[model samples]
Target: MSGHDHVRFLTKNMRVDLALIAGMIAPGSRVLDIGCGDGSLIDHLFQTKACDARGIEIDMAEVTQAVAYGLPVMHGDADVDLAHYPDNAFDYVVLSRALQAVERPREVLAQMLRIGTRAVVSFPNFGHWLVRWQLLATGRMPMTATWDRPWHETPNIHPCTIRDFFILCEEEGYVVEQWLAADDGGRRTPWRRFLNLANIFGEQGVFLLRRR
Candidate 1:
């Protein structure tokens, strides 16, 4: 299918975090998306912004699906594959909803900033009030929309909060260009102005960052 057709098929189907990450990227620039399931974001970027968008997905099934749809997605792991790219190879490297799943998230993030001018990362906020409330009420792992899978079955290993991410950025000397807390319902603006409030209420945290 054409890029336009692929994008049309993906409208409203794109994850809220992916849309937010796309908005942070400039048009007509190179983009690399990690854990890019079926290359939906890449298709959207290529069709709408004229970006040279490509992706790497660990799942061979997803890689094949993306390739069938004419997307440039390779089977690769973020923990290892990112090191092969040269410095500043792209304008942006995006990791949407997959940071916590990577075995070495900090290293992956560093590699992303190394190979791209900027990095956009989005992950479920473990500090959300709903998560806390659920855990407290049930004495078990929470199961919200973002964290739906059972603890034993979930891919997330090092789930972090918005505050935790901010601290990591500070420790790594990465500049936070922009950040926001958004929900799955496509509401991107709520609680963005208040970090503490966002940590309590926001379902997820999206951040655009660059190395200091």
Candidate 2:
């Protein structure tokens, strides 16, 4: 499918992240999407940015959906298969809502940096105030659209804070080129001034990072 068609398929709620992705990617760039569930983002990139996009997903169902759309997607674990790609093979690598699910986030991030000039990472912010309130007051894991699964069934293995991500980036020699925070509807939130405090209340966070 053409890039324009892919963009049109995206629901209006997803447009915010799509805009952010468009800002990071240049036209006709090569992209690799890790844990690309259903290939929605890859399709958007291909159609809107004219990108050459490929994806790696673990779920057979999602792979099927991606394939139905004629997207190039391989069924594989991000932890094990990402290493097979040559160094600097893609202009950008993307991990949207997938970082928190991996057992080794640091390792996966390192591999992303090695294989791409830049990477875009987006995840639900556990530091959001509602989540904290749920844990503190209700003593139960929060259930939101992005994190709706029960604790036992949830794919997230490494729930992280905004501060935690910054620390990891520093340790891994990555620089945050751009950062954005969003609510459930993908609307931007004010996180820069009150990241330490606001992140606990924010909904989600997205980062555009480059290897230092």
Candidate 3:
């Protein structure tokens, strides 16, 4: 059976970022999941919301696995391949935990907005208090649950803070529809009420954006 056919009891297991992204999506909309590791989120959306969900993953092994499980996933690089998709082909284009790793984040985001009506982005916050404390105390790169890899081995080439992201959005003239910040344990705070505090305290951030 395809992964979509057997998608069951898995949404509950999604990471906090994925769950947040799901809530931002409207039911039955077309979705293009960029850097979709194993097609889990797309499969969940397809099964529960009857959405048309497809994915692009850079890892060939992951792509093969997702396809074998009956998900419509293709092997592709997000930075290079996003240009090939026509304008507004999908309702949502998601880049979950993969933004920092892209070669050109600005270009990738521009393409995402071009190809989809809205874009969802989730990434770990490099300015969390814990990260700051660790760096201050140890004079080394900090590691958190979401950013488990050592600095030398990490794929995040352009790690950024929540405030940085907001500034980037403002500079690019993208409209932020909604956003949230949470701790590593997935507990969300009244982050909207205090964006700066959230930048230092929150472990991760998810944003819903649209062209201005």
lDDT of 2 by residue, 1-212 (tens): 11222222222224456566667778899999877767878888888889999998777776878899899998888788889999999999988766777778899999999999999988778888777877889888888665676888666768887878888899888999988777766777766656676476667778899998
Model 3 lDDT tens row, 31-55:
9998887798899899988999999
By TM-score, the better pick of 2 and 3 is 3
Collision pairs in model 1: none
lDDT of each: 0.85, 0.77, 0.83
Q: What stretches of model 3 exceed 4 Å from their correct place?
A: 1-14
Candidate 1 positional error at 81, Å: 0.6
lDDT, candidate 2, residue 196? 76
User: Against the true structure, what is each candidate's TM-score?
Assistant: 0.92, 0.87, 0.91
lDDT, model 1 = 0.85
Better of 1 and 2 by TM-score: 1
Off by over 4 Å in 1: 1-14
Native-to-model Cα distance after best TM-score fit, residue 208 in candidate 3, in Å = 0.3
lDDT of 1 by residue, 66-120 (tens): 9999999998888889999999999999988778778898999999999999999
